[model samples]
Target: MANWVRISSRSIGNHIRKRMNQGFIGSAVDINKSSGSSSALHGGRTVCDRNRRYLNSLPWNRATLFWFQRFKSTVAEKQQDSFLSSDTDDDQLSLDFPGGKVSYTSDMNFISESSQTRVPCYRVLDDDGELIKDTDFQQVSKEAAVKMYSKMVNLQIMDTIFYEAQRQGRISFYLTSAGEEAINIASAAALTEQDIILPQYREPGVLLWRGFTLQEFADQCFGNKADYGKGRQMPIHYGSKKHNFFTISSPIATQLPQAAGIAYSLKMDNKKACVVSYIGDGGTSEGDFHAGLNFAAVMEAPVIFFCRNNGWAISTNVWEQFRSDGIVVKGRAYGIRSIRVDGNDALAVYTAVSAAREMAVNEQRPILIEALTYRVGHHSTSDDSTKYRQSDEIVYWKNARNPVNRFRNWVQSNGWWSDQQETQLRSSVRKQVIISLIGLDIHNLHFFSDT
Candidate 1:
């Protein structure tokens, strides 16, 4: 029996082979080093330090030391716990060299079933309401942040006032983008006045931010004499020749391909403008969706296909619409760069769209941004979402990720505003909305004959 043992698979196999070769084990074998090293008196000797003054040592002890040194190095090289692996097939023994080089060997048995299969959401703002920024987090200027915040706040206030007017029978109908202010206004903030805005009916925030006055909004809403569409279009289907905002359409996704065409025209003229078109998540299921993405990719057209994924199209939830992941992935299949962002965050939406606009203008590539969000209000004044969507779902969107409230929080957190200031701002907006609504009542205005 040995006092200390060094066991190796190779050593065990060699010992077994040697035992078969010999008839019997020797009673004792005296060891001697080839060099003039120590030989102990007793056949079984205690190992001594090699570096000691006794220069001579036992050959067997020297051999044992050499074997162990090699064995320890080999074991250390292969030692890695497989329990912590993110991938099951990997053995997890990784060599971290001086320069950041890594190597891996696959061992299927070491893989675990508990590995994460889905990507966690990438966002700067955490669920706990903390601001997190990193190099990967897209950064925009503070000036842009404040301006975007102001526009979103204004749009939200306007949406509430106008929707309430519709409920009170003061107006025929109105579309409220209550939870969509960040997606609508921040994306508009990302664009230039020269760029074309192909808006779906719910995105009045774009027009309002681009200097469409309250009076102009009222005129369009009322279909009065001052209306830009000359009372030919219905309320809120506003557009401007000078402002570069395209007229809003009633058909589901008509503006999508129209945006591609407009983008093609911009390329034809070698203009600096890029076209941005907004649509609902449900709109991406339409034929126009495929045509728009394909046409833009083929032409290398400068268009930003913005999808506001507000979780519902009329009474239908997003789960009922498609089974093939989100809308952003669909855009990627078209050979267009696509991004998905927290549409509740104005800063995130603005930064994303601004970068997309830059890529569209500089690289001449069409891009798509699917803004993951929810609409707390009805799909439109004519439809009721409460019929299908859970009341709690609407409440979740209204309280949790409310675009208006998020911007307000960002505003206050940054010392850009106070609660008193916010109250005053809301009060001012309400007063202005009332004035604009009252001014729209005109006895001299003629009615539209067109159906």
Candidate 2:
């Protein structure tokens, strides 16, 4: 080591020397099988078995072809633009230098003010409930599709009632996964319940789909004796060790690194499970997101970082999130595999996450997913959307682009669901909420019986 100056001279030469003198930090995972024995037991399934199970559940089954036959014929009369286009474009920054012609440069950004290409958002269906992607559609079985739709609807209904319960002073606080039902349930549907899930506050639907009861949700929110946390945590923060779902934390992006560490531990144990960590577009702004992603990539942690880019961080628009390309680009920076999915499309999210799960565990690599969606409701009860954004903007996403309704139309088109099913499901959900909320007094519940 030598004496180094903290300040540098004012010149490009000094800047170059300064950068070179700085120590380079690295986070990389050595992709190797761990030798240590794992005493912990997983779901009694081998890696190959789980892979086969996942592949079999994909849209490649016989039902997919038959369903598309009827779906295509009905839509043949309609004229629409093709949906199967390349996800990227050829856009380069060229410069005429004194020596010769030069095209892209890593050291210098030739085009500063304008973007070279648009970040592609992956989608399976158009808003009109048509298969827009030219590639063979990823299809779920009719049963699976119907199940996914029901869960999506269930999540929406839960948010509505719980949110109202908060407004009526039944609960101290709440956060609605309103516009994000697809991100919550669809991704959860794609994953095995044994795979660990570390979530921020907005992903309660993951627990709901993993057999967490409606009464449990109410109990946690109301801090009753039945709550796993025993009423010590703030409302809406829930977790279950049995379900392998980690409790929600109010701190943004803190779960990312934790997921990476857990995945690394799973790798050491040679377990076939991967870790999936979820964060919002706003959470990406946190420093933990960077550290977690870099560590996961460098350490070869089998983690999938699911970022729900809902276009707002509290009142801050995504425009304020960052100047660079969206969150997907950050994955590239960390040397991790990444994708951009249509967050509002249940099938698209499910397909993407399912595939990501395979790649993460089998290949022993960290993956990132940037889901494009909008926040349809206020951030939480503490927030008011009208103060920072326009009502029309919210209405557009909430109505025309509601994820629940969009997927419902697709499933119903195949005759898997109908009005009667919808009515019955909604009624059942309402009754569940009523039972959960009314059984015990708001305060002095069993949780309060102790000191």
Candidate 3:
């Protein structure tokens, strides 16, 4: 039995050494013979001291040392006996799988349904737009803050007018960013122009931030000859190569895997930018979402997977979605760092994205941000949310938790804006939208007449 145990241990050690040589383990285990300490070098960081101590307590043999090092875990320290110890209790044993460490037990046990703990949502501002005490955030200058508010207002107005145009049969379809204006604009404000964006259909505010003119938006939505897509894509399927924005695809979750690949490309070329991919809560249900996250995590791609958890995917509410504590936990499942932020709080979203961008670029890793907000508008011109969700819920989000109102309150608290300025900005933006539409109409008419 002793000889058999030795042989098996040697075999396991050989396999581990082979894996290490193939770069699976990245680097070799380093043993400090004089100090009686053992450490593994991975990516230039020392292995945890606990792991070092656990390794040192083992028999001083290559096979034994490699085996423990490969499967080190927090619960491992309790199991100091030989692997073949008949006195060992099943409850004291731990198995370290590729996913993570798990304790083994002889008792019939099952993971509880109540084990899912809701992740805390991060917020810097209250519903009334007052900063919460003891909260920290990246501060924005007055000029930058005002610009963010203006763009959010612009996006809201644009959505309203364009949705009206679709209803008037001037366009085919439209999606509003009503309750999510803060998310749309604040996240865009956090990123640089050099960063690539893979947007779902609802993020026109990003393009607006990148200098995509109202005329350009109108042309694309109208599918005119002047449109960059040359009338091939549908309305709201907007993209601009000049702006580093990928065209929106109708299929759900397709952009996620693509974003991972783009991020990998940027990393290979040593670019100082990252990729930001946006998805709705419903999109998280797709297989592409899993594939994208796993791929990015394994490749260590610099990408930010931003999920707009707006409580509904078309007519299907988020309750009908997966049962695991929302989308942020899915990031941990894939070994990606993640956070949940208040999407209605522009300051919170901006601060979270700013930190996420820095970490993604500097660490060359992926991040998942689950922005908790409510969809105050219908899914699109194609579906009515009122049919499934309560009218009061919509009204509550639109009024009590309105992103525009909350941000305007913050700006007003600083005395940076006034009612007159608000009135003038709204008037100016409304006129601009109308004028852009009229200009597109005239240009199209002239082209047809000449033809």
- The alpha-carbon RMSD values of the candidates against the true structure, listed in the order shown, are 25.8, 16.8, 12.1
Provide the lowest-lDDT 10-residue window in model 2: 23-32
Winner on TM-score between 1 and 2 is 2
Cα TM-score per model: 0.70, 0.73, 0.76
The segments of candidate 2 whose C-alpha lies over 4 angstroms from its true place after superposition are 1-115, 440-451
In angstroms, the error of model 3 at 133 is 1.0
Pairs that collide in candidate 3 are none
* Candidate 1 C-alpha lDDT tens digits along 195-252: 9999888788888889988878888888888888888888789899888988887898
- Residue 87 shift from truth in candidate 3, angstroms: 20
Worst 10 residues of 1 by lDDT: 69-78
Q: Rank the candidates by TM-score, best first.
A: 3, 2, 1
The TM-score between candidate 2 and the true structure equals 0.73
Tens digit per residue, CA lDDT, model 3, 383-410: 8887888899999999999999999999
Listed per model in order, the count of residue pairs whose N, CA or C atoms clash below 3 Å is 5, 7, 0
Q: Which stretches of model 1 miss by more than 4 angstroms?
A: 1-122, 127-129, 133-135, 138-142, 440-451
